[model samples]
Target: MADTSPSEAGNAPLDQMGLDNFAPYLMNRIMGRYNAALSAEMAALGLTTPQMRSLAVLSVTDGILIRELAVYAVVQQSTLSRALDALVRDGLVRRETDATDSRATRVYLT
Candidate 1:
């Protein structure tokens, strides 16, 4: 195989950006385009990116609490609640209390 020449390697600052850089940048570019399309397709279904994320998390995990959703959604509790509210209003999700811990509320995809 041909070797990587000195300058064949990217500039130092770019290399310093490294794998961490590529993953988010590339993922964001792809997701941005995909989200644009998804937004239009799912608009009639009343779903937004945040709402879809919440539903996916609840569906996969199957009964995580609101606090856990906040973590999974990578947002503040208030933000997750607002997202969940829209989803619940749209009939895509339901929240139930944990009998063992009245303070805990688990969310599930309806």
Candidate 2:
């Protein structure tokens, strides 16, 4: 006969567990669905998820540094840079170098 001990039951497969026990899993799934819906709407405006996020942040904090935008937008600098390039091309955003720090670039919504 197989050993069906109480202790062994604790190691049961995740499929047997309640999903409500995993907050991160639930949150991720919720966000995924939300982004999917929002992405479709934004796509009609010729904007991507990243671009929408950047604009949302810029709306509140215009002339924010590129590095700051990355953090606020929850996007990597390299990825945000590409999105910003497209936004600039579309005349939706303006990119300017910081006067005091030439190495830093700031972005504003146009």
Q: What C-alpha lDDT do the candidate models reach, one value each?
A: 0.79, 0.92
Worst 10 residues of 2 by lDDT: 5-14
Best by lDDT: 2
Off by over 4 Å in 2: 1-17
Tell me the TM-score of each prediction against the true structure: 0.67, 0.82
Q: Write the per-residue lDDT of candidate 2 for residues 1-110, one digit (tens) a residue.
A: 79885448675455656677666789999999999999999999999999999999999999999999999999999999999999999999999999999999999999
